[model samples]
Target: MGMLKLEARHLLAAAGAAVMISAPASAATLEVHIGSFKNGGTIPSKYAFCVPAAEGHTTGGANINPRISWSKGPRGTKSYAIIVYDNKAPAEHREMMNKEGVTMTADIKRHNFYHWVLVDIPPNVTSIKEGADSNARVVHGKPATPSAAGVKGLNDYTKVMAANDATKGQYYGYDGPCPPWNDDVVHAYHFAVYALSASSLDLPKDFDGPAAEDAMKGKILAQGETVGLYTQNPTKGAKASK
Candidate 1:
């Protein structure tokens, strides 16, 4: 599920950080994880998206999304939200709609890519489907479908992405990878979950990354993360270059 991967790279930390926020009332400490694997766990082969030797290829792996779970969040946590992104992308994080936010490599534009952004998730939610957005799909172009379980946030890719060569459209959800062809390094996808006092954050519907992060400046009570790596290529000699 690499829907808005390009745009999410910029907004996840910058934009989403402020979206759903509330001063935490509980003292619970939330622990992050990947499926059942605890944080800092090994990166699985099936989840590796890039490698040192897989230089010019696109991988057949699912989106970097992982089954996530958390606990010990502060009291009054009415909802939880999730965001997945490539924090290792070049410092080229910015609005994909603007030239300033972009970087050129091999004559192609490579900017921040978005993966998944989910919001309005109820506090009781303890686990996300293993491959929820792995297919890199979405509804009405928003970041995610809110899991029958939550509200999906619009990823940054929607602002400047064009389904066709003619016009740019608003990207509403997850967009998978298309990293630079010559990226000397594999990118790191950071999957973070935030525990909030409310089920949803109060922000504008069409908000971008920086704007959303601003909205949640002080509302998070507890948070944790699950990290995964991804890229267009995989090394042949390694353990699938996970």
Candidate 2:
């Protein structure tokens, strides 16, 4: 479990830096780690602009690409996919869904929330540049892969803001967090690295997190990740919690 754990859910909401392969990955597994200019090339800073946790700080011009670095890709690993998610979301995603308007209730905290899901990455790529996907929004059903190579997957954010045109669109790529304006603890964003046998996970069209994971099941050579923490409440941003 990367960015977000399966059971992790943030009631108030919102959500690493690292690398240390204690065990050898599957025959040169494609490893991904978070890094930041503030953390000396580690994971992205919890105080970045896109995150609600870093609300008042003004992001100091921090970019979205979290300085991801990787190594030891699996043999014949055509390409790689990275996913960042928040484990602290409402257990049942639709529990808060309503007819006229589905709203995220303040009481409905702690649920599975997927912040980012990227697919079809070029196997040759080791990592992404900082701020590459940050808070940018693209088109619907379009290929949202990086200019280098690959395609984008539908992140959970798509359905979240779909009602409003300005924010509506298929989140085919990365979309950072801006969780509740108020909350308790900082949310954890698990950055998972998967080494796949194919260039992409070929599942039914418009697959989500669980779907993608199932498609890649058993096919994954190895996976590893580093986590970063962010909280809507600024006090929690301290390094100790990370």
Candidate 3:
């Protein structure tokens, strides 16, 4: 009887091992990269909007979208979405910041400024070559062209320039960062990619970042992100006043 009991235990252990071996591998975390800036590194001025300068009008950068690539998405990922957001933008204090002598600081609670939102990227697509999605000058908008691989959504620039007669329009696609010039701290921009289960988001043409995020709620299988920093103030070493 004792021998029989020991054999039964051995069989159960073997069955457990077999089950473990046959189980499918878990999904993997995606890897993302930006060729223009190192992770957590400073973003060049050419990628930002023009700022007033002593010498002449100077742009924060070239206003071109950086080259971005991703790999190792989950096995069943059918499509992808990209959102470039500035977490340090003074969204809540926009009106206050425009007042004379008012300054934005690191201590301020910032808000998301969606600079880019591109979705419905087919699984076969992996990278966006630099400048392919943006122009050297800031255009009012750039709706997804018929030949484009993905759909472009309205960026926060539309709201930022809503009152400006010269720039106000339905800004779309990638519009690089243009933080307040007098801000006391450098702003971090997150470029994140989400792998979705569906082949297409099928969102409306007017969809923005928030709308896209809502649509992708439960469908995201994996995600990856890289951050880049930028500042318009030359006094980078100065600390914000308490």
Count backbone clashes in candidate 1. 44
Worst 10 residues of 2 by lDDT: 11-20
Which tens-of-lDDT digit does each residue in 97-170 have in candidate 3? 53446677767776778998999999999898888888665555565564256888989888877888887888
Worst ten in a row by lDDT for model 3: 15-24
lDDT of 1: 0.51
Off by over 4 Å in 2: 1-30, 37-63, 91-109, 134-147, 203-205, 235-242
TM-score of each: 0.62, 0.65, 0.80
* Whole-model lDDT values for every prediction: 0.51, 0.53, 0.70
Candidate 1 per-residue lDDT, tens place, 43-80, comes to 44344333223432334343344566777467777887
Error of 3 at 176 (Å): 0.5
Q: How far out, in Å, is residue 116 in model 1?
A: 1.7
- Give RMSD to native, each candidate: 8.1, 8.1, 15.4
Kindly list the per-residue Cα lDDT of model 2 for residues 1-242, writing each as its tens digit: 13223213441233322222233334344446666522111234432434432334322223254667778575777777777676754454443332224445445546556666776677778787765666433434235545444555677767777777765766665656544433443455667777677777775546666667666765666676656555443334422222
- Model 2's TM-score against the true structure: 0.65
